[model samples]
Target: MFNEIEAIIGKAKKNKNYTQRGAVPSEEIADLESQLKIVLPKDYKYFIKHYGYCFWFGGVVSGLVGDNKRYEKLCCAIRKTKYYHDFYDHDSSYLSVPQQGLVIGKWAGGGYYFLFSQESERAGEVGLFLTETYGQEVSKFNSFTDYLSFLVTGTPDPEPVDVDYDRIMDIIED
Candidate 1:
């Protein structure tokens, strides 16, 4: 999946004449993996290794200046997946791929959001997603790799609330 995302980003970068935006290069990703002490999911690693920073979401940091086809395809694909059904309804908007491991979504407050998991704790995932999607509005993470490190090892980071987990478990128990 990551490799495919990378190819798509490369094509978009070339065709659209925009500099790649808000992406962490592979080296940085590697360093992040090392710091966090976790192996990234194969699909996630594939994306960073091949595409550098571009992911399913593209228009955030780089400006709305890349290949629309690539962006559209990502949105379309995600919309069609079971993952979408599980986390989000069909009505949500595709946000941005803020970092290697996170995808952001915006929907009516009742709908759940999508998040691609890494080995790190939930706080790290939230932090990475927040920084990447919001950019300067949020503080920069200590390092791109630090985000990955948080995902894999789940170490040395604050715990994040698992809203989905809590809700689902509540439903099941009820």
Candidate 2:
């Protein structure tokens, strides 16, 4: 899966901003789960385990191993810092995140791509959330893998029909 993404990204002539890094150590994954107090989805685990610090438009705006400076890591690095653009407050972000929801990725604008970790029915599904205009948080795809596929390629990883990105996009544009 990682290789496939890299291939698509490689094909793009405008991929200079996207940076895909090496895999995260298994021990680090375990430690992150322990610290975050949440069980990561299997696909998500596989993704970070294979790729780290990966994303487009300057950095990985989503996932655990995203760019540290522009994106927040779920561990101690972001808890005390106030540089990233997370919707939830940083001091209590950890406690609120896995419980309320988990933000896996983000769009170039202000919307966030998330998963509802506390709700089993919504488990593994990823969504987009834009709080600025009081927009609804809507599902974007079926899983983390789906989101990544869309990111590297112009195609949907799982392709969702229920998502209302267009509605939110309209609101965002206003």
Candidate 1's TM-score: 0.30
Top lDDT model: 2
lDDT of 1 by residue, 59-111 (tens): 32211112344553233223322343443333223233323233323222222
TM-score of each: 0.30, 0.62
Q: In candidate 2, which residue ranges exceed 4 Å CA deviation? A: 1-14, 58-61, 65-101, 117-119, 133-135, 157-174
How would you encode candidate 2's per-residue C-alpha lDDT over 68-120 as one tens digit per residue? 55444432222322222344445331222334345565445765566554345
Location of the lowest summed lDDT over 10 successive residues in candidate 2:
75-84
Model 1: lDDT of residue 92: 28
Leading candidate by TM-score: 2
Superposed Cα deviation of residue 50, candidate 2 (Å): 1.1
Q: Deviation in angstroms for 124 in model 1?
A: 15
Q: Lowest summed lDDT over 10 consecutive residues: which window, candidate 1?
A: 57-66
Name the lDDT value of residue 69 in candidate 1. Answer: 49
